[model samples]
Target: MKNPVLVALFCLMQTLILAQSPTPSKPRILISTDIGGTDPDDNQSMTHLLMNSDLFQFEGLVSSPSYGEGNKKEILRMIDIYEKDLPKLNKHNKKLAKPDFLRSICKQGRKGNAPFSGYTTATEGSDWIIKCAKKQSEHPLWILDWGGLEDIAQALHDAPEIQHKIRIYWIGGPNKKWSANSYAYIAENFPNLFFIEVNSSYYGFFSNNTEPDTINTSDYYNRVIQGGGHLGMDFKNYYDGEIKMGDSPSLFYMMDGNPEKPERESWGGSFEKITYSPRTIYNQTTTLKDTVAFCSIIEIHLKGPKIEIPSDSVCFWMEIPYGKTIQKWPGYHLGNGDYAIRYIPKKAENLHYRFTSKIAEINGLEGDIVVSNLWPGKKHSTDYPLGNHWYSDKSDINLYDEKIQGGKTVLKWRNVILDDWAKRWKWLK
Candidate 1:
């Protein structure tokens, strides 16, 4: 007989090869977005999601609003457009979910942000989430929270048994500001919950860090996306033809890389590790932020005894991005310990900007302060809505106060003007 040991070894090698084969299985996704609410970028994200529908095993599309309003009608409106373009989309990939099926699965969740407790009874959307979680699946269903977490929170509250079956990828930053109660409840109570709080990583979609070569939102809409088809035309009709889909990174993260392993560098963005909580024995590493360069402006507020400067000496300092010739404006103390400077970068890449002061007391920090795009878009004065700036909490809405406690300097970057780009591009051919 042939050597039994050699035969066994050959079989083991075959198994190993199959295991490393790079072909990743499709991830199951349930999109919970506030599409029709304050920001319309979620609409752009929805368009991208539908365009790449074959990549995911979509379970649900819940209209979970951030504050007290939602747009189930808007969800249907997109579905209507998808239905018109369904035949052509199917030609590209037959796995695309039928419009009728998507319509059937689409449901309206809670109409606003959650109460202090995070639970405000179960809604149709919340119940749907629970139902989807109960289904048999080899992979954990990813709950992509594009808006408030009230629906997901409710689902978890109602059915604690499904906690292990679902993984949450929350696009925090501004969303968390509006849904603080719900976010706080989840963070405080559900330490074991597999959650990836993407606070600032989503900026990669719009950032020009990989400019010229990489197709950003502005370039994508101007070149390939705008006026391409019905979807393109529809996209141009919103945000004045600008291709700002900030929330789409959640989908991109899953679409490009191995969804089973999020830590790997992907189109969504690379993440650093952070300790979850101090109270929990189950210590876990959470995604801190995207490592991508200058996706957004870095606002540094120098304070404490380290930043104390004498009245006789000039306290101004200059910050220059490492390895770059450009230098941002000098930092000036507004009052008290608040020494602030705003940097609008030319490129989007992770680089340490050396902070140097002419005064001897201000010099010598151990390491270069790590700066990356942690917010949405550039530091413009008109990116998001006037009343709903991304950095300002709706509950604690104060635009005038740049210094809001904690000795941190809050930036007054521009708010996005919805439909401004589309209105400007009305003449687009």
Candidate 2:
């Protein structure tokens, strides 16, 4: 006979461990930001990063500038604030990385964008990257480039062997424009590097299409972050108490779920495959919500082999763009079995439009009807690659040419509400 009480206690302990260990093993991350310069957005991004520091085993915070300004001291200043706030942060989650630990990882990278060739002498930051990548770890080192690629370029140039050990997520758009020369160089040479250029998708976090109550970065400061605590005060000081951390999506992708599965939806946004250049270009996948933010009209085109179906019952209802009334559009059969419907989004609030049929099922002759945003497609007036606006639209193209340096990648920003605010203010409650 077994001791009943002891068996019960052991079972309870196992359950507790499982509950506490809900978060997967932490990912290795190294943040390369250009704060204290042209834009103060990086300050907000860094604050968000520190608040979620428990999610990643931070490797380094390098000051890698593209143009106007970048200083390692600014990063240290934020870390000092984080040091003071650690006690409060620890109250919510005791496993947060210590301020001194983050301090030791902070280093300065390249001062500005590299020359057109993209190779300059390696610096302290580049060397640090090489060292971190070489260190034995099961997970790949995720380098979040909040600024230029000069330091990254330099790292790859010096140690070409470590390309597989690193995965780069570049917040490129305007940043790409600044680092055109270096970006071109990387694209031309390192065709096998694993990289994701975050262009328009990050803009979704601060888009005007969503409601202010949704707690996007646009109103997150006023609603949740402002009066929280030490972390709150530091965040306020960054951009005059505004929430414009466009770079937080990079961290978001790593936080909520497995960052490796970018194809599935999450708080950060979803991604889809693109034509593989030297680096695999993963563009941010768009949803119905992202339709209105980037375009004035949303179009749907469906095509399939000519089939027999109940046409009388099929109808679509969409919000009259920016209005309350719901309008329905009748599906028109275009000569063959092809079907088409066009509707402008009614509201800037959310995506709530769909096509419905009264029939239970339909017999198809050939294949599934392709549903896509036809308006964003290339017109007769456009070139092979199409216009740059489509980079953020529903139909986006992946590009890697040195001559065409306009669109890197466009992401659809999500109006996600996370618990960072609730945890920071938990003590008060």
Candidate 3:
């Protein structure tokens, strides 16, 4: 014989406790980053992740620098700092992953972007991705891509079966500029892969457009993160301690909300389903009339005299306006003297290019291409139909920011997200 009032109170308490508790099972995550690369913000993001390591089942930390001098050594450097901070982090949560285990998972991916064909060869990091995706688990692996997609592209190229078992949240934009070839390869081949391409949307994580003064980029690290711990102290080495973890939104997206529904509002910026992604092809050197969208993949096909060279390497060189420097990309020989090169325009400008090969007929072949300001969206007709992919909808008025284009979706949650993180920073103190 139990009292009805007491039983009702007990039920209410249980409901509140359940609502406050984190998900019983941790989400499996594998982070592929270009740490210690051109962008030092990765250091900041890594520090943030280690501080909150308990929230995820971290399976891998891969160094995947597409450009610049970044490698697994940088990841190990961060782990070294984490090792010192582990005592403090463990005080708050003993579930924090061990430094030795994290070091074991640290792998080096490709040193540069993929060739015109997308994937070149598999690396330790790419192999690890395939291995983790194949592991027996009820939940899919969430790959947080903070760098180029070269490794992921290579892994998928090697093991297509894992496409359905893994999800990717890539911090694109500039990274897309670096890994355009691999991006095109994946978009065209693995159309069914569950991916969230956060191009400009991730900018919201650091946007100061409409944020509280306390957590503004210039002040938050000093106020909330500076004295937090060893990791916090080391965070000042990059960007002079200003918080510009543009890649942190991928982490925030999984922190407090349902990652299964990306369209729904979350601390991470909301994304939309886009059937088509921008892409274009040219049979010859393009003119202004044959303008292509910025950041979109453009493939150029050219014909040369039917002469086979003993060597397999062919080069595509594009002349830049600045200092009249030439940047080289790999060109593929498509049998019968046909050659092709895939290029991604990083800006709205005209580009001049030439091909160089051992075959004299293809050597010094020059052409011009016109790039437009048009970006990928409904307004752009030149796009590839991706069967199912999620990306930041640049057309969405609600998510638009005058400063960052499509970063408002994540910008709107700045205060709430930072406040939550600020509370966690206290644990290190």
Clashes of each: 21, 12, 0
- Model 2 lDDT tens row, 1-429: 299999999999999999988565688999988898889899988877887777788999999987777899999999888887777677778987888888899999989766435667989999999999999988899998899888898998999888889887777755764565466567556766666666556665555444444545445667777666777777777667766677887887777677666555655655554332211111222253332321122334455455565442233222222255644344433435555443322112345444443322212211111222222222321112211111121233342111121112212224333454455555422
lDDT of 1 by residue, 1-429 (tens): 299999999999999999989876688899999998768888888887876777788899999996646668788899898777777666656887788888888989998665445677999999999999999877888888899888888888899889788887777666764565466556555656777666654553454443233334455577555665577778876687676677876776676656555555555544433333111111111123423222223334555344455421335544454454643344445456545443333233444455466545445431233334323323333221221101211112222122211001111110112222333223223
Candidate 3: tens digits of C-alpha lDDT, residues 275-358: 877777677777666777666787778777665643233544543344555566677666677777777776567877666666
Q: Which candidate is the best by lDDT?
A: 3
Whole-model Cα lDDT per candidate? 0.60, 0.61, 0.81
Which pairs of residues collide in candidate 3? none
The TM-score ranking, best first, is 3, 2, 1
For candidate 2, give the lDDT.
0.61
Off by over 4 Å in 1: 1-24, 208-212, 277-429
**Superior by TM-score: candidate 1 or candidate 2:** 2
